[model samples]
Target: MKKITTRLATMDDIDQLADMFDAYRQFYELAPDLALSRQFIRDRMLGSESVLILAEDEEGASAGFCQLYPTFCSLAAAPIYALYDLYVRPEARKLGAGRALLLAAEAHALRNGALRLDLTTAKTNLAAQSLYTALGWQRDDIFYAYSKTLAA
Candidate 1:
């Protein structure tokens, strides 16, 4: 495993981050489109709509990335974050890059006075589940997640 350094992503990282984002979407059976991926990530990062973290290898190349969105918890009366995306390159998995990115996000959330961090993964993603569980993330038994697509 190579040494992994995690840091908040900047505009300079857009190209690599976009490539990784596209690969991530493809891993979940989505079609590949570097243009769309680039634009989406750029917009989120530039607009301050999300927190982006990038994991760099020893050579300073991007090895993985994670994106988090801020949200509020009315009941808890505190800020929270939705870790919407977490992806490590195929060659980078099990190298601790993913864990490093996750820990960085946790630290960011805590620094912002967030009370919790939440995320969801496909039901078939056992590897992700295992990683999250190993990081002390427990499965929620309280409520179900429901969504409806408003656009095509």
Candidate 2:
């Protein structure tokens, strides 16, 4: 297994991060658009509204990334984070990069005094669910997620 290192993503990592993000979106059958991906990540990084962590191998190549958004839990009166995305390159899966990215995100949440972290994965992604379960993440049994597209 290769040694994996995780760190907060920087502007220098935008190109690789964008590519990985595009792949991640496509994994859910979304259309590919590098420019849109780049701009989305750029805005998040510049606005500081979210945190993006990148996993790299010993050779300094990007292996994976996880993006988290800060949110508040009004009822709990505490901070929370929504882990919107996590992805490891096909060649990097099972090499500890994904786990490293997850751990890194958990550490960031703890460091920021967040009370909890939440995420949703596709129902068909059993492998990812296994990983989340192994990492002590509980399956949400309380509520279902709903979304509606807004007019642009």
Candidate 3:
């Protein structure tokens, strides 16, 4: 495995990040639309709506990326981060990029005074569940997450 490095992404990284973002949506069964991917990532960066982390391999190729949204957990009464997206390129799997990205996200959250970092993965994504477990993330057995689609 090659060395994987992670850092907060800046506007200059939009191009590479958009490419991986497109793949990430495809991983979730969304139709591929490179233009849409670029615009969405650009909007986030422009609006400062989400914190983006970029991971790169030793040769400086895009390895993976993670997105975090700063929000507060009402029960905790403190700021927290929702780790909404985490994706490693197909070829980058098992190279430690995912782990590196998650670590970077946590460091960022802590530095910003967040109480904790939270994330949800598909029930069938066993690999991601395992990684979260190994990283000391505890599953919330007490609450069942539910959501309803709203009209756009």
Candidate 4:
């Protein structure tokens, strides 16, 4: 079996990260927009608003990527990270790329003194939910999440 390696992503990784990000957005039924994706990832990296981790296969191919955004938890009065994205290429599935990326994100959060890491997946994404739970992430059954979109 090929080994997977995970690391913190740098600006130089924007191209690979953008490709994976575009694919991830497409997984949510969004249209493919590599240019926009590249810009978004580049902005995030340059702005230092998010922490990204990349996973590479034994051959150094882009296997997966995960991103974490730091935010304050009002109720808890503490710092936390929102794990906004995680994706593994189709050919990389079942090879532990996703799990590796997730673990790397968690480690980064912990090292940064984050209170906790939070994430939400589509309700129909059972595979992701399963992976999260199996990795000891508690499912929030206490509070219902609501979102409101404002006109731009």
79 Cα displacement, candidate 3 (Å):
0.4
TM-score of every candidate: 0.97, 0.97, 0.97, 0.96
lDDT of 3 by residue, 2-90 (tens): 99999899999999999999999999999999999999999999999999999998899999999999999999899999999999998
lDDT of 4 by residue, 85-148 (tens): 9999999988998889888988898899999999999989898888999999999899999999
Clashing pairs in 4: none
TM-score of 3: 0.97
Which 10-residue window of candidate 4 scores lowest in summed lDDT?
Answer: 97-106
Residue pairs in collision within model 1: none
Per-residue accuracy of model 1 over 44-67 as CA lDDT, tens digit each: 988999999999999998889999
lDDT of each: 0.95, 0.95, 0.95, 0.93
Q: 1-152, model 2: which lDDT tens digit per residue?
A: 78999999999899999999999999999899999999999999999988999999999999999999999999999999999999999999999988899899999999999999999999999999999999999998999999998995
List candidate 2 stretches off by more than 4 Å: none
Stretches of candidate 1 above 4 Å error? none
Candidate 3 vs 4: which has more lDDT: 3
Off by over 4 Å in 3: none
**Which parts of model 4 have CA positions greater than 4 angstroms off?**
none
Models, CA RMSD each: 0.8, 0.9, 0.9, 1.0
